[model samples]
Target: MAVRHRLIRTSPRSVWAVLADGTRYAEWVVGTASSRPVRGHWPELGSAIGFEVRLGPVSLSNETVVRRCEPGEALELEAKAGPLGTARISIELRPWGDQCLVLVDEHPLRGAGGTLHNVAVEALIQIRHRTMLARLAKICETEAAEAEQRRPLGQVVSPHPDEGGPRA
Candidate 1:
């Protein structure tokens, strides 16, 4: 298993918003390009999104299906990458002060990936997770900042609606 965590300078709701948006998958998910919703509403249980993976001159279509979803909390997905096999990915968001602690856990579940899983694959996943988590953080932080900039100076918008307004 490859597990990594990042503390994003934004609310969990903010992080969830990014995860909930299927169109943003390629932005934060390493190596994927042009993500789009394919079946159902993304992030909902059983929903799926399709994306293209490019390896040099080869381009393949991969699909990720949501297996479980706890809004504003966690998302569990199964990513099918053609013959390379499927991988299980889990993302969890926990509120920390005014920010969000995001955790990502991934492992090969089936196909070539499962058969070839080893220390090298684990190491590569770790590196990919690092890049993926950083990208996620940057998106959440930048979006939060932009939202703040657009808000009236004298007003405060509660990023976490379930947690009430303003943080001391």
Candidate 2:
């Protein structure tokens, strides 16, 4: 398994707001160039998103299904990448100080990826997870900042116990 964690300077609900938006899938997910809802309501178990991954001149279509969802807490997905088979990706959100600690756990479940799973593959996954988690944090922080800006300067918004202070 490839596991990684990131501290996002946003409340769990703020982080979840990004995750719950199906249209933002490509913005944070590594390698995904674009994403669209394919079936059902996104974030709901069994709902799916179709995404395209581009590598130079080649573009591949992949589909990911929501395997499990716990509002504001967790989401688990199964991503199918053609001959690469499928991978299980589980994301958990934990409240820490006023912020959200996001944990990602991923593993190859089937296909060539599963058969070839090894330490080298895990190392690559770790690298990818690092980038993905950073992107997610950036997106969440940016969105939260934008939302805060929309509010009046003196209007206080309740801070999440985990998020600490204002994000920079």
Candidate 3:
């Protein structure tokens, strides 16, 4: 099993927003070249997303199905990697002040992956999780910053525009 956590400088809502958009998975998930919703609605239980993983000229097709979901709190998935077998991935979100702490847990459930699982595999998964969480954090933080910049001014207008409050 591989377990890792990351502290994202954004609200859980923002992180969940990214997760809820299945098409965005490739942007944050390690090794996923592209992703698209294949069945039902992504992140919803039983819904699945198809993704292609490319390594140089070689490409492998895989699909991940949502096994469980708790809206902004948690998401559990079963990722099928053809003959390599399947793995269970669980993601949890916890509120830390105004920020979000994301935890990821994964383990091989069946197939060759499970049969061949060992310390080296666990280490590899740890590295993947570390990179994946960093990618997710970057996306969420950047999105939050962009959203802040785009937000309309509050009701209170500043007497001087240079003061940085809402312009009169």
RMSD of each: 2.1, 3.8, 5.7
- Compared with the true structure, the alpha-carbon lDDT of candidate 3 equals 0.93
Candidate 3: regions farther than 4 A off: 155-168
User: Order of candidates by TM-score, top first?
Assistant: 1, 2, 3
- Model 1 global lDDT (CA atoms, 0 to 1): 0.92
**Global lDDT of each model?**
0.92, 0.92, 0.93
lDDT of 1 by residue, 1-168 (tens): 999999999989889999999999999999997799999998899999999988899899979999999999999999998888999999999989988999999999989999999999999999999999999999999998998898776775665565777643
Q: How many steric clashes between backbone atoms does each model show?
A: 0, 10, 0
Candidate 3, poorest ten consecutive residues by summed lDDT: 153-162
Give lDDT tens digits, candidate 2, residues 15-82.
99889988888998989999999999999999999999999999999899999999999999999999
Point to the candidate with the largest TM-score. Answer: 1
Give, for candidate 1, the lowest lDDT window spanning 10 residues. Answer: 159-168
Decoy 1 TM-score against native: 0.94
How well is each residue in 87-166 modelled by candidate 3, as lDDT tens digits? 99999999898789999999999899999999999999999999999999999999989977776766554434358956
> For every model shown, what is its TM-score relative to the native structure?
0.94, 0.92, 0.90
RMSD of 3: 5.7
